[model samples]
Target: MSGTKPMGTDEHDAARTERLRKAMRCLEGGQFAQARVLIEPLCDDRRADVILAHALAGSGRSTRAARMLCRLAHDNPTARHPAQDMMTLLLRHSRLEEIEVTLRATLRQTPDDIRLYDQLGEFLLLHGRTDEAIEVLIEGCRRHPSALRTGNLLAVTQNETGEAQKAQALLRHLLSYHPQSAMTHANLAHILTVDNRMDEALHHHARALELRPDDPHIHLNHAMTLLKAGRHAQGWPEYEWRLRIPGRLKYPAERLLPTLRQDSDLSGQRILILSEAGLGDMLMYLRFVPALVRRGARVTLQVPREILPLAARIYGVERVIDPLRPVPAHDWHCPFGSLPRVLGQTSDIIGAPIPYLHADPHKVLVWEDYMPPRPGLRVGLVWGGASRPGVAQAQAIDRKRSMNLAQLAPLATVPGLYLINLQRGQHARQMIDIPEGMQLYDPMDDVRDMDDTAAIIMNLDLVVSVDTSIVHLAGALGRPVIMMDRYDNCWRWQSGRSDSQWYPGLRIVRQDRPGAWDGVVARVRDMLLPARPDNP
Candidate 1:
């Protein structure tokens, strides 16, 4: 009790101040137990109490921390840090309803804070509560009609959620008022590019780049625009700005190659190729490693630990390193994303072999033993992509590209076609709800990573999947793959192309409308009929 209050003396007050500061320092350094011990004594102050709650949460006492946050929020609705902290904690714990209540309560007490509206709307959108997000964002825009950031978010959301006309109208209206806004131009460029309006999209992208020459995000957007339009010669340079964008990749210290040139002779150059982005991108770019090897470069490849066995089998890879460990000694290092820019402008340098990835022959033989005895075309199905809830933009794109297993249940009725499940991650639970009759050959329960997946894929006749890493793996193996694509698909697939430029055996079944997967499913199902073993 005595520790909770300062003695009525200058010496004691000074000691208390020092103690609180030390506790805050501990919290900031993530020493949660130490922070809790120090902050508990000075819990009389609201700021001290907030620190105590943070320490509790950090120490894994999330329920207790959440309760304390609720009380603190109810007592002082205008406290900025605690409310934001509570939102993050609740989101991690999936206590979503409370997040909305706390956000609304904070906004009510401090109605003039425009940031609260933005936070609430973004939270709703991240969780896929589209209607609520739209309402909140609309109200926010109405209240602060001149606010470009919120309006831009609202317009993007509208475009994604089946209201493209409304989104276009909002962006154009915002542009009429704020003609000089770089964000408005960039977002409009995004929507235009998605609709295949190449000329208009490029113009807006140029305008945005002209307005904000140093903005990495705008440059990345413009890069995607050019790449999607198949103008890769011009796009590769713009795409280099992706390295400058925030949260793209993790680099270790200042050890990377200072510069690389396309025409440089690589005779005996020790090159370390680190993964730049997603696993799919790594697969896409590993094709160029053969070229590096042919150039007399000793290529040491670092890939995701799960794919180590598979990556080790690439034709010209001198060494395969695990991604979890620190990068080993090398003369120069290059991330896979930079490979296209370094290798060539539009065309890949020669010697990137087709079917560069191969499964272990023994593993394939073992998996073949577990295959269905019935003589039929073995078709693998991957109905969903990874649900990356932590990254909002990635999650939003996943929602558009992935579909439930139920949407693909109709394929089970196809004669001489047996469906195999090749999906993992949070979405794998959909297998339990497989619509009664769709018997899936789900060897995923025993599969560890891409190595195991590749082994199993070798037993299948075809792989049908949404846009995910599996498609890359299948394509790399030179297997026939039917990719169920979104309307606004990746730049690699390009525009209006059913055949892939990268993989000869891969076929794309694209959605005609945004956020529509039924058409994609139907096309895949219809196309599979000809491939059925009993069709002839």
Candidate 2:
């Protein structure tokens, strides 16, 4: 405000000008309440008022802001952009009645602003008004055929609404002109992955990485491609890049021997190993902890507060530190996953001991007392995962990849074998869908996390799950687990192999083609059917 130029000769005009500048500064600093205080009286200038309303809307004061913007738009009939912005704010925030009024009024004012139409369409899609969104976006695309954002959003809508071919066509058309568009490449790669075209997805993701080398998203996608393509040697490094990605919680910084030279001595030194990422990843990499302990380092590991009590009881570590507590001092530190690189891992050196990692016996005993006994061979089932942000986000709810509760009901009737429910969250609702006459053990109703989940898993004879964290959990425990995978299984499992470099006791049941879980399930049934002797 101090550096502001006078907008007009009068003192009032100059004062208003300075006030607007102050408001702009406040808005940029995310102090919207202060911005509103400065800008509220400046509604006399139509342009200034519109900008202020936009600031308010962005700050989550949508109701008052939307009304003010609408009024400002009405006062100046020629200001279509502000009117559109107001309508968008209404569509995003206002009640349904207000949204309808805003939409109709805005459309009547500018019947040809295709971007406005696109915004309304996107709103409709978000609110589950799919049919309306599709109709509107289709018309907008027809009018503004070159609008890349509109086309991309429309393509996603189409894909979700069961028009995969149309979505593919729209994305492909966009790619024709914007050949180097990283977003387009990523979206196309997603479609290709669903279609079982792993090679095509890999190429497009590679192209995306070339276009935006530093984008963590593209790097993650590339890592997914490599994992899916059975190139684990290169994939794990890029996968570790999540820690440095913007907006993600960074691994707690610590002083360390920045360079762990090949000849570094670690005899009797106290080391801190901090867990990063999800519960599944922590479990997956715990196999390498014993290696650190063997190096004569007294390993004190840190994990999320919730998992600390259980992790403390895990084998191979002298102590477990909950990050919520004051961080204990150590000679050197590294993230949980970085141990592989620090220990100089190569393709030849899996260095993994099956069942090397162990949870607390006390907790396992606690779960054991709660688990109900079944008649015969005990089998655990987990068909879904906690929603992950990257590639696994889309795969999180694939009914095609997961065994339908009803489809699995038949397994329950198999004599002498009991089905245990190990799946969690929204997917756990499938429990109600289980057919009568099948015994289901559901100790997970009170189980809080992987530690509890691991305890329950210890009591079961076998674990059958789709690609999920539980698969990793069961494998780390050196339990016999069947991993039912999509045709192009996750890269960690690799290609054309039943054995995994990550887990020794795991067996893979893979789909022959895209969305072909029926065959995979049938193979699983074949393997389990004979083991259940009382089936006759």
**CA shift at 198, candidate 2, in angstroms?**
4.4
What TM-score, over all chains together, does every model reach? 0.83, 0.74
Candidate 1 residue pairs in clash (backbone atoms < 3 Å): none
Give a tens-digit lDDT track for model 1, residues 384-484.
88766678788878888889888897788788888888989877898777786788887888897889899999999999999999998999998999999
Candidate 2 residue-wise lDDT, 414-516, digit = tens? 6677777888877789777666776777887798767787788888899999887788878877899998887645556767777787887889988776566
Model 1 worst lDDT run, 10 consecutive residues = 344-353
TM-score of 1: 0.83
Task: Evaluate model 1: give its lDDT.
Answer: 0.81
**Model 1 misplaced regions, further than 4 Å:** 1-99, 109-113, 246-263, 345-351, 531-536
Cα lDDT computed for each candidate against the true fold: 0.81, 0.70
Total clashes for model 1:
0
